[model samples]
Target chain A: MKDRKPLYLMTPALAWLTAFMVIPCLLILALAFFRRGLYGGIEYTFTLENLALVFDPLYAGIFLKSAAIAGLSALIAVIIGYAAAFAIAAAPSRRQPILLFFAVLPFWSNYLVRTYAWIVLLNREGLITGLARWLGYDAEMPRLLYTEGAVVVGLVYNYLPFVILACYAPLSRLNPEIAEASRDLGASSWTTFRRVVLPMTVPGIATGFVFVFVLSIGNFVTPALLGGGQFQMIGNLIYAQFLTANDWPFGAALSMVLIAIMMGLLTLQTFATERASGAKREES
Target chain B: MASLANPRLMLAILAAVFAFLYVPISVLVALSFNDGGLPTAWTGFSTRWYGELLHNRDIMSAAFNTLVVAVVSTVLATILGSLLAIGVEIRRRKGRFLETIIFAPMIIPDIVLAIALLSFFSLLNVTMGLHTVILSHVVFNLAFVCSVVRARLKTFDWSIVEASTDLGASTPVTLVRIVLPVMLPAVIAGALLAFTLSVDEFIIAFFTAGAGRDSITLPMQIFAMIRFGVTPEINALATIVMAVSVIALTLSQRLNRGGLPGQ
Candidate 1:
């Protein structure tokens, strides 16, 4: 009771993170302000040219495109995941835990395996094509793989479990009586959902949307694997800058931008959650 | 109003979403056993790819390296993370800065952390290898472990610790003899989770494991194989990797009902 700063227990782990995670991230931040050397080394001079370049029309276009893809994936994932979560929530309460478990099981698997699963399904000679041909559809099929759509599908597929998990929380906690009361007042089912259930669940939707968007925006694997490197998302751009273009400063700068976008979305998610709880408190 | 609770409609939605989620991975798993080893058609069943996998020296070595990294990192992460969790929970001060430190790794984009670690390691001229990969893995592994342990601590009774201290037991003795035993399931659950994450981590390992094939983990190997295209070996490998994670996560879930970070 007397000791105020008894941090002995946390010191080791915090020190490790500070050294490895915090210091490294800070190094990258500082590196963004420096110049890239002729031999791809980082030079010891400060400059904002790299940060300025992040908004260069060329780079900014990639940012916008990445956002679009990420936004689309997040949208689709939230829709489908919300539906799934709602279905699970409507099930018998005793079965809800197991249902949620099965829904989220796929998320635990390796990320690359999950992405490669899309590759198997969407390849030109893959299962979908085989099924199409078997169905006697003798028309030129649109390319199924290596497209932006494929990248979005990959992103959605990979992150959908997370959305389902997020949405299920609020849906499960929802007091059925509220919906009953809304309907008792002659509110249509859709009207009740739109005005009552949906409003209560906005925080979950916000979290799910932000999670998928933040992950998808900087995703290198899905685009690389499914987009065939043609749709150079911000992720692949960062990859090339560091590994191939040998520009450490630019890569650092690009990641800084990515971090900023992530932080902004996360802040919004936090705000939504806090506001939601605040409103709930007023209701009580 | 009946539509909202319509069992048939709810079942259909669940079926479609689950199919959408599972069908792709299921196909990959099914194809791994195809005797013909062709993406186009399934022949008879065989374990030929798994057998071939055993003989692939690079994959064998990569698996060995992955195991080494996973085990070592999980041990470090569990010990440090459990201690960190206890430390954070026991203290009266609930600092936002400390919470952010614990939370950042779980949400930070993988590539950002990977590149940051790469830059840091190279700046210090640390020769990158499995060692460097282990170092980076602990950064996130400990965070995940901490979060999981901290979740179990939410329901923990603090009065017991004060009581134990009042009975003349030292702080470390009370923690070791009292708190650790109570949260042992969570600690183990967190360790299994950390092991799975370290085993499956790829992007970070790919960057930090510089200048040699010697440091390649299983996921890095799988990524390289995947980029080459659809091959029987990759399907088989993906099946094994998926199975490992699924099994580990299930155990973790059983050990701590609310083990997952968000849950």
Candidate 2:
């Protein structure tokens, strides 16, 4: 009877998730296998053409490009974020929370507003140009806004705090004794960090990398607003299929591929985490 | 070890990272007050653009729509999510599938969820409006609220509930008189977080809101204005929106950490 109580309590939320989240996701998956109607609607005929088109050279090129951009952004963010997290963790313990709090505060702000801030900074007559003119470089200002670099900067700026938080978790939790023992055994600080500290924190690095990569790859807004209309990432392709071209099947297929990539990364992250913890267990 | 690295280097790195995080935002806020409405040059400081925002009907309607969506969705999400959290924590046997379902809304790309909900509603022949936005927001909002509440529940003492039950209190009575009061702070924190998220969320609201001016949210309005170009009015609007989110999230974080030792 007591066990049944939990089931009863869970029913409402489960029902809600099933109706809204689960069923809708399943609907999209099913939609991917159907044909597009002549008039911008879905037809009830089964077809694999939509899935096949996702692997076509043109679309596949976009996928590879998106991955490259996402990977680059993740790599840069992880480097910067890891350094910030390490610095925070090394700070006086009393100051760590306060520092971490402010670090992540910007992340809580409106995403669009944060992204739009870049526009104000990078636009033709924006702050960067104003500064350039102030320095007496009176030639035509270089185009900074609506470029690939702008998109990469926007992704890094938006996702950096998350990476910092992820990295900080393992860094702060690290046992100091192991590093001390490494030093006592004549190992240099760099060697200690590489052999002991970095090994234990692989999970954090993996988590941050996977997170930034996943979100960046699937991002539409950053590319749309910052990369301009010409830069076609997978997200923009999906957006075009749904809202512009009215090709729902193709859009669904693209999203499925996106989901596949996300699942793969996330599974790898979980595996990395488990392995790291297993290594820790062996150490203790 | 600490002596090996220069303290100046650490401080410099910290300063540089903070500058990278904050400089653009500070520039936008400062320009919102610029008398010259263009970013080309700052003539002086003025609040004229803020006054202009007050007179814009499109922005006004979008703001109103956003409030409605945020408030309604936050309430529904708080109720559903708190219950779900309590239930899950009590069961203590959550399967991998269940955990994935709960976590999915947090990590799923907003565009995918937006389109999925858009497709779902349209196929059901349901009219899209602010109501659809509210419904869709609840899906993600509830997940966030659940996670927050569940985190709080981790440190909760189950013995109190047993004590209340032993004294002949009914389930509802025990829940209301015992559990709810203990969980109130976290619940409020979760609600605030949900409210802030719903207010700022754009893509999902955009796709699910259908084609209508009546349902346009503040973020959507901001997006449209941004696409055209940056304006001082957008700066004012952005400042206000960012302030609200920062304030709400700060309050939420404080409340979540309240009564915890050394926080």
Candidate 3:
């Protein structure tokens, strides 16, 4: 078998990754420990001030808010997705793949476009407004496009397909006999679901939750567009710092914190997935 | 499980979920053809927005840049990614470290990677432009391409390679004459996926495209248009972008029967 030559062949991918991924990530890590320049460039002097600024009440508040909003979106998406996946799984096996494909099809499209779709629906002059007025309500309409609720809705809609995809896998792979056995053992449907099905699918739920949360937290577009200028998620803040504010050092610092949070959550998710899988193995 | 057999609830849920997913997209697509300036009003059907898109120089240039970036990045990513996948799959000794590092690009947050690449380029005095966007995009694009190709490789039969080798074919000759033909479909599928990602990618391009309208890509143009307030032009642009993605991914999935990446 080819050996050394193949390893050499992998060098290009490795080199590209090292140059663009590893090195850049390290550069940001280094930037986080440095001071911001007065003119929006980096200062060579090493300091913890940038990192410290990340924890300041103002920035920390933004971080917490981003996390909360992301959490809410993830939670909502999981519930909606779980229900949908459950329904799909219940369908005849022959039709399941097509159902699953449509469920996930929209997600593969442009992310920005999907978020913009909500803008068309929720903007003051958008469809919802037109519909509301046609229904004869003359009251002052609520602002819909640029709000926290709109952001959550956008995140949920954009990510629902993925949540369905994640949740559907375990559901489809589930052995119906296990559920039937539980049913024959006299457990209620809800009880069997809670104790048997839910436990079995905990890994999927965790995966979906983590996937949604991570993407939503670092998501700049949805909040920027749907939440409008008022909403500042971590992603938006980082964007502003780098582009508008031109505070590269501080932006790098904020990005580091964002990565740290993502990594932490991802690590926790891995543990959760493994534990659930371990339990499943025990059941087997 | 029992409750799921209830057709009424199942159908309702399915309808609701599809509506939630499809409504916004349909609305956007429908609005693109609306003659009225506002999204709510559809006085007449017109292709005016698409016509307006052609006349708009800023958007046209952005579209051109997007095409250039997507094509260049996808080509480079496909080549490197296909090689990497073949190499990784062929090797008997697959290191966990190598696997994890290769997969890291797919999982990393875009914002983080964007800033990281931005800082890395600025620090290295590497001028940020379409080239930088292509380079940064290839990082993730290659990972995706590798994944798709690797999935195909998993179901690949290795005995053919041994047979070809036993017949005294050289390594390169064997790969060219044997593996290439078989893996061609997956390679094309991977290239399609990479193209789709590069086209849709915004944040990475936003950061790396440098500060000027000259280097702006379609997503950047769309972003500027949206922030400047929605216009019929944006609806048109968004429609085109989404259509491109759907077409590319549908084709990719057709070739690769497994599933789309990140699924």
| Candidate 2 collision pairs | none
lDDT of 2 by residue, A1-284 (tens): 15557676667777878888888889999999999999998899999999999999999999999999999999999999988888888888899899999899999999999999999999988899889999999999878999899999999999999999999999989877777888899988788888878888899999999999999999999999999786899999998998899999899999999999999999999998999899889978
Error of 2 at B126 (Å): 0.5
Report, for every candidate in turn, its global Cα lDDT versus the true structure: 0.91, 0.91, 0.89
lDDT of 3 at A234: 94
TM-score for chain A as predicted in candidate 3: 0.97
RMSD of each: 2.5, 1.8, 2.6
- The complex in candidate 1 yields a DockQ of 0.67
In what order do the candidates fall by DockQ, top score first?
3, 1, 2
Q: List the residue pairs that clash in candidate 3.
A: none
- Candidate 3 CA-lDDT value: 0.89
Q: What fraction of the genuine interface contacts, i.e. the true contacts, does candidate 2 reproduce?
A: 0.60
TM-score of 3: 0.96
Report the lDDT tens digits of candidate 3 across residue range A54-132: 9999999999999999999999999999999999998888898999999999988888888888888888888998899
Between candidates 2 and 3, the one scoring higher on TM-score is 2
Q: Clashes per prediction?
A: 0, 0, 0
